[model samples]
Target: MKKIKNVRTVALDGLNAIENNQAYSNLLLNSLIEKNKLPQKDIPLLTEIIYGTLQRKLTLDYYLSFFLKGKKKIDDWVQNLLRLSLYQMVYLDRIPDRAVLFEAVEIAKARGHRGIASMVNGTLRNIQRNGLPEIEEIKDPIERISVKTSTPKWLVKRLSNQYGIEVAEQIFLEQLKPAKQTARVNVNKATVENVLELLQKDGLEVTKGEIVPESIQVIKGNIAHSHVFKQGLYTIQDESSMLVAKALDINEGEMVLDSCAAPGGKSTHIAEMLSNTGKVISLDLHEHKVKLIEGQASRLGLTNVETKVMDARKVGEHFQAETFDKILVDAPCTGFGVIRRKPEIKYSKTDKDVHSLATIQKEILQAVAPLLKRGGLLVYSTCTVDQEENSNVIYDFLQQTCDFIKDDTLASRMPEKVAAHVDNGELQILPQYFQSDGFYISALRKKV
Candidate 1:
């Protein structure tokens, strides 16, 4: 108990990074783990507590606000300590409330004075006695969805307006916490069956991904830092994201382009699918990001990938029309679909931001359209659910562009589990619906 508390205190350093250093949760958390050299067994608990509190910040505050009595005041460290404690109390049944409260008091005492410790003790005891406050009482629909799902009100309003109230509420609710560690098995190194064997050998309960045939969801494993990941036996990717490579349908020796590829999860997947025989030109907006694709390619032992820095929105002037066998416009967007994986996104984004990103989506799609060969395939995708960034742009592009047609077999690569969403020349995946990030993809073919 004492050791775990010490580790929790260490994690607070990353929380400080999140607040003052402008660090991402994943990057910050990983850095803290490396620097502190925390034991592997504690990673699950530390990660759960950190991500859970961040994911449900608004909901936690809403419940805790009731415990604030007599013009109550609390310092930042006390608030953060209470947030972590309350998250454990409400979400983790294994940890007793007494233990949680004890840890909270200890953390409060270390970072603050006796006055703050007493308040922390009183507030946690009140929650233990009264239970979680009723979030159902929030009258405003936007605020209700926001608090219930722990998303920001602005995001709630935008999603409600975009995808009717019912679906929007469902999406937000699903985004609160979800299965985000889906990965694709590297068949070149080991078959899915063999990979499952290896994971099971390590006492990890793994399952085949529901949507993509080659994708696997590690239900009970932390092989990310283990030899499996380091040796490049598997790549972490959502099952829905794995669908993009299949949708592209690139054959070996074909020339392909991933115009907005950076982190190269999709680019390397394409190389693997083509049996490492095709040319995958990976272009991103920044030179520094090319190393990510290069690293992944090297780890996966994929030599087919070529990384460059070029904005897809301006690539028309550089690449000739119909020059490549396939082109991917993984356009940047509002990223609404990935909120479950990146809960902070809901708070960081605004309503106006969606439309601004939509303009970029349209521009990138339009510019990349001319670079596709007359008979080539173009697969447009985003980690967002907004229609303005999904169906709308493709609708407008087909009307204005020449020699493009919706390819019917594009959805055929998706497993039957996601067949229902396969519609109208495009298929969309919801976060919880597929137990993956919310992603949308539309496939188009340049006519001969």
Candidate 2:
């Protein structure tokens, strides 16, 4: 029989894979857990160590630097062992510091040479005894928030420039935390009360979402694993994301287009809103993603959605001009807003990436603009906090397209709690304020 690997050892392997870009944290860890048949109880700690280590990487490295004092260059594995252990030391109050240090030394010895083991022991011990350096020593304001919040320096500066120092810091801090699990009820299959009763019957702690009536916030348990989930009673979607399709406000028998639709969250939601009546065209760039949309529609028993593997930038080439009653350009983005769920984004994305994604977002928006009929609603949305990809893209689009104007009707369609966040026909939901993923949504109408 194959022995189950130690949780720390498995976590270290997961961290190494993430460092080498072999896989993302979530996928790698889940793969490791399943492949090794890891114990159910140990899963949480393993998850905490890996995510906590990556989530607090920059901050941990900054603290480790004070101890090393630029004295030695250790092997990457040794450095990572110390990183994971120190993550527990600094962030996890439940794990004793001495236990963390001992685990690091042991893991180091098991994974590396004796010398490396000694180095890990010495460095972590020094930190436990002496504590981290004062963050105030970082002179630059942007650098200060970057290190303190463990976000990239470029993002800190950009957010500061866009929202000013105070709000930028808030955004940075919010990215370091984990996002809650929220799901949208498929009203076609089950009402909110019906789904809530079913979820509660399964012993899952859930509450109705404050902004969107169709959404529910799951406080505990793996909600997607519930029997009700398999019944197509609901879908796992962020509450903020559930608002995008609502902003479109499609009517029965009116055709709708979802440019850049993938995984079919919004497309299926739109189909649900239509009560499976009118047609909904879900377009994705890749064939595999198109299948995802198809699968979602099939599972929801929605016959109105038609999946197509086509680039959103060339959407006008396939359909006639002004052919659809509503258009949703949920453009690809830098995804700075979703760092809470994917902490690696804090390091993976750069300013150049943000600028590049903004261009693509603009191209997709301009390409799909002609497809909307006169007076048809066009809602542009992104799961990002970057201004270049959000408000700036919309501003630039408005400059180029005189036939389109901002539609403030987005507020009237949403609950009052959600409507309060709308401004000038655009809603930018910051993660900190909403306790959900950061997102931006803007509604526009084609001039008759």
Candidate 3:
């Protein structure tokens, strides 16, 4: 079973899966890589192309419009093929123009008509000759950001409403760039220094984490494929995500439950903070997802984590009242904070999705509230930055829930760089704030 070198061909399968089959981008890319068993070099290339195409589709299409100005008609495959090829030519400096077109022509011929292949070749060549059209003439920042960066108009508009033009534009621009590949060193397995030494020895560059002391940011390394990750030496995570566990300020022996734990990033972080002592029940809605928690716990050699495939909204039957010292509702939301990493969300997400997700967040929060013992802590967080999902949710909860108050611990815990944005007992991190995702976290304490 020889691996494939036709990166564009592999990427087209993924693009078509997203465009025609409604598959998620990440899942489809992973599936394509597995099926082809692409060599390590092509993995990043194909991923970058596929995601880059999806990320800047609007801008690519806008540029293509100028190329098609001669009333020269094109078909669906031609359009998609041109979009794919031109993404590399205009945006990616590493791939030479002729190479990108050659691969695209091969893909076009394999999957499309000869005429369409010619169309792709002409459009991409025209792009190289004419250069991309100037976008500064566009007056509206939303449209400008959307056109220049390849984000959707609807998303730019929504973000403008949420964060205003100046900040929202930065977020949109950030989405166009690559994200930091960060990982938290599992203190139980290796110290940050040890992980740094190991990664450096492995011919990789890494940095000490900007936030947590045990956290190490990988500046350049495939930690996932390295022995460091396999040995549970570290777990890939965003620096902003690591803040959730730190904000909790857990001691060595407190019981903590990561409700809705999936692909368990925070669940393991919490366990490490507890020094692998006491209990951490990682609960999710599916057995498959719970396995993610179990996997992380195993990798980190954390014996204290107990994974359960139970819904966070309906876990009362198994646990005693006031059983846990702390409960974390990393409630699922619209994922607005992470749109940069998952750019497809910009096009596919809707206002209705946010409302639906907010409803679930409220339900999960209320259900998990009783699980915490008196004086116990509850940290409600969402990757979204909307008021509806953040402060507003907390506000409505506190108006009636007399036993809990917004914990001021966050004010004291705020990093010097993050303090200016902390407001009214809630930390709303706009992505541009820390080169991180837009996150909302509020600490709540039971009256005791």
Candidate 4:
């Protein structure tokens, strides 16, 4: 573990770790930023370089391939250095090409032999001298989209099959852009208006969210460190995720189960909806994750959230039948919907992973189905646009159980724009749909 001092070095190291599957992009970048103690201004640049390089990795590689035609065994670090330099040179117009090339050569010399630094300099200088390879020349549509958008060809094809090619391309194009920073107002402690005013006073560019009524979209400045957030006035959550608690249709005095809750965003939201009158039992498989739920609950001054360390699939062993008034199975999936924030998912996940997760999602749903009280509501949601893990899973579950039916009232609980997407009580929200995470939410009700 050598020390990472500058933004470029940090970004390069982060990219290498992600490329080797040694770390996830989000976690690795955060760790690197903290370890380096980078300046606030430098943090954005570091984030941009790393995420931009990752978001357009295939495109960058395509551009590099034309230049590195004879090079067969390029070291991962050297390649990453080249990619980082090229990303800044191509995407970041604010930074001149001379500065990017100088940093690349300097970092290369510091880390590798002079010959390697020369090679790095030559590759980038050549790329700068002659523009990147043309992506439009690619004959295949899937390959063109994959390289153009830096998405995997398999993913492009899957989305294309699920959504038409046009919509899938739109989804890819949207994910290439940055994710919006939105937070849910803790209505128990502050009104959306009050939070907006306070955040604005603090110099944050803020506005009401488009989808969820309680959400505030942060246009600029980090809201997590604001006094309002410290006071539990709001919780940083995606606008789409805030819809999960709402879809659950929680009441003031009811036992709600967040079967797979971790880092408890939805659980705390449910607790707020309960107005501290009832308990929201949050469960996660790992002890550390359960602690995350507890930490969030404590931070929000929510005393009604009871956290448990248990596997969601084993809910039958711990709880009696028909116990909870409402349940949320925010089951894990392929995570294709959140690529804008975590670009690694595009290359890391596979079709096999999707099928495997679908199986686990179904198991979690079946395991929790009996625990809901007769006529109790259960909301199934995933941060993925994959139909197999979303609609297919819900449809299969309905076929297996006669006691539950799609809750038609789910539409009424959603925003008008989102409500129109609801079909048979399931809403598959694409990233292009509202510039939100590709999310799915479905409500099911057990027969009374």
Candidate 5:
């Protein structure tokens, strides 16, 4: 890879890769940052350009459409350059319009012919002079929300139908903001107060997490690379995600199963809650993912986590019925919840994806049901706010499985601020509600 000298070019290349290869924004951006060895100061600009462009892609394209009208086709890279430039000019107030225009033209000239550079220059100058097109002009409410928030029309409609239009709009707007960096304190290694003091001593801005009691929000600096994190005193996780282990209500000597566990955030949290006395059988479909679980366990010095590479739907084949005291089905879904962190998901996922994932979720729950002991809790979770993949899936499962009943005490286990939203043992957390990822968690108890 050629060394990119500036953040604009880096941002443009990242955007092109994401568009051409269907790459995830977060993974691709992180890889780009590491490969380029970007200066500490440039990293933030590169991240903002890439994520902001992706987050507001539809709106940026709408602005570009007015300028590109009747023009000959341009290369994807050229379009990406314009999108990133437009993103900085319109959304980022810190960067001046002249600097954005200068960088766009320079990058275009360096990578393309003078003709392409001129076109880029002219298009940007034209926008600066004429101003952006009006999002309000779009008459359809769904279309307006879609362009205004850079969300898909189908998703906007789906959310609006599920949660009223006003709430859906709030969710979309909330996703446009940056995600908070939070870490879960490994109480087995250090108390929350101790970890906060250590992190602050390291010059990181830290504060108590709003929702999960064991979590702390990093107001500044990367906590993942902090000494405390590497010491296994804490693990970086979203505050909403930290709630999973707490919902399980683990005891010291119980046997817990984490179905579809990967990158082991929740699995390790469960292990810590058990105080290393109980065993957490963490399973994922791929060997590489299982290794991730093992790696986290090793780093955290957690001895009670046992990892296995197995399809969650095939758990019954290897384990005896009623073999575990508790089970977690953190089944995969459309991932509509973490849009602020992975903005590409908004465009990449579709209505069909939601329904298909719902089917897979139900299957996973059915396969794991028999493995839980009588009266043992089975917690279901997904990082999505879509009803089809969350509540609807749980509703359908409860209808079919006669042995399991909703655990009404689930709300009491959650933070008091969030407890009121729990209904019939289910909690659907929207991004707007707590400024966290849109997550859904529900609990069921085997009553037979």
Candidate 6:
């Protein structure tokens, strides 16, 4: 029998896998699209449905509770199907409610029994007729934002506490927008102007980055599949990520250490900054991920990057003290800043995780402190907007070490548009500010 391979079915399966923590949404969705050979047109719709379903899951459940009142225990898949359908009916204006309902019923029938199909049909129809409950009715402000934004209440509370309610709401809403694909021009391989023209010639709607000269935002088409990428003319990276390497300001013949470097975006960029003349020793705890740095270095034709499989916390032990001219600690965090790209992170992380990550980040910084040359630079960065993992970690680190002080040169390195955000030495970029991922970057210089 031919398999029922609808876009919604694929989304439902992906949603179940993400909710079960089996795989991340982006990787799983791409894998399914390629494995099933889903139509190119359906790719956008499928991605929207999966991300939308996950992003608005809390809000969907809130509305679902009213409809499912007095009902028996529901299977997880059925619930996921209903959530997927409700996400479309509620958020996606292009997809008609009737079409969404029909597709949901068909998918339920294929995946479950007739009884489940009837429940889906009846529930969705009832939602269409009666509409969802008002979010205003939710009493608690945190819970209200949580449901309305489909963000975890704990996160909502944390953001609100850190940056008042208005900014928190801004951050919450920003995550709902679909993430745009951006890439950095491998200036070593090709000039930015040349790369942009080539990307345009390849039919990509490209635009210059607002914050970085080396970045071009792809308005349409997949740059990864383009012939230009195969030639290593550009690399697919977020605009914020490109800034971390720039903050390091490595000169030719300098030696740099990228602690926690994997999938080597910043590490390779550091190599590119040196005109491929300096060495960038990239380290990651996992040997498998270390290959990613090697692969990226090879792709960009950068000979300066050397990959090593070792814990970032053991850098001092691996290398002699004051050996590196500069170091980058792109520490791992809760990933709160990148919710637009990975909606599942908001649900999986907690306050405890943030503090715990800060601990590890501090350890990495402490261990690598002795490895940097006197007067050398160290850049700390994360994909998250969380204060604890960013400035707090640095502040705590500074209190312990007298050899390092905040490097204010970071402001001069930034584009004029963002120069104002760099205060003293730390910067937190909200995703909405640049229409990019939320990021935090800070720079410190080792004293003589």
- Candidate 1 positional error at 316, Å: 3.1
Candidate 3 vs candidate 5, TM-score winner: 5
- Pairs with backbone N, CA or C atoms under 3 Å apart (clashes), candidate 2: none
Q: For residues 1-448, write the lDDT of model 3, one tens digit per residue.
A: 4646577878877887788777888678778988887887788888888888988888888888887887556666667778888888877898788888788888878777787778778777877787888898888777888798676777678768866877778877776777778888888777789989989999999888775566677777578789778898889998888888877768889989899889899999999888889888899998988888898889889999989889888977788889889889999887878876777777787878877888888888888888899998899888987777888788888886889998877767666677566776689887777777788889999988
Clash-forming residue pairs, model 4: none
Winner on TM-score (2 vs 4): 4
Off by over 4 Å in 5: 1-4
What are the candidates' C-alpha RMSDs?
A: 2.5, 1.4, 2.1, 1.5, 1.2, 1.2
lDDT of 2 by residue, 274-381 (tens): 998989999998999999899888877889999889999988779999899999999898787888788888788888898889999999998998888998999999
Candidate 5 lDDT over residue span 20-46, tens digit each: 999988889889989888998998888
lDDT of 4 at 52: 94
Could you tell me every candidate's TM-score relative to the true structure?
0.93, 0.97, 0.94, 0.98, 0.98, 0.98
What local lDDT score does residue 76 receive in model 5, on the 0 to 100 scale?
91
Q: Write one digit per residue (lDDT tens) for candidate 4, span 180-294.
A: 9999998888899999999999999999999898999999999978878878888899988988998998889999999999989999999999999989999999999999999
Strongest candidate by TM-score: 5
lDDT of 6 by residue, 13-122 (tens): 89888877658987898899987789898998998889888888888999999999999999999999999999898888988899999998998888888999999999
Which portions of model 3 show Cα errors greater than 4 Å?
A: 1-5, 69-76
Candidate 2 TM-score to native: 0.97
User: How many clashes (backbone atoms < 3 Å, residues ≥3 apart in a chain or on different chains) does model 6 have?
Assistant: 0
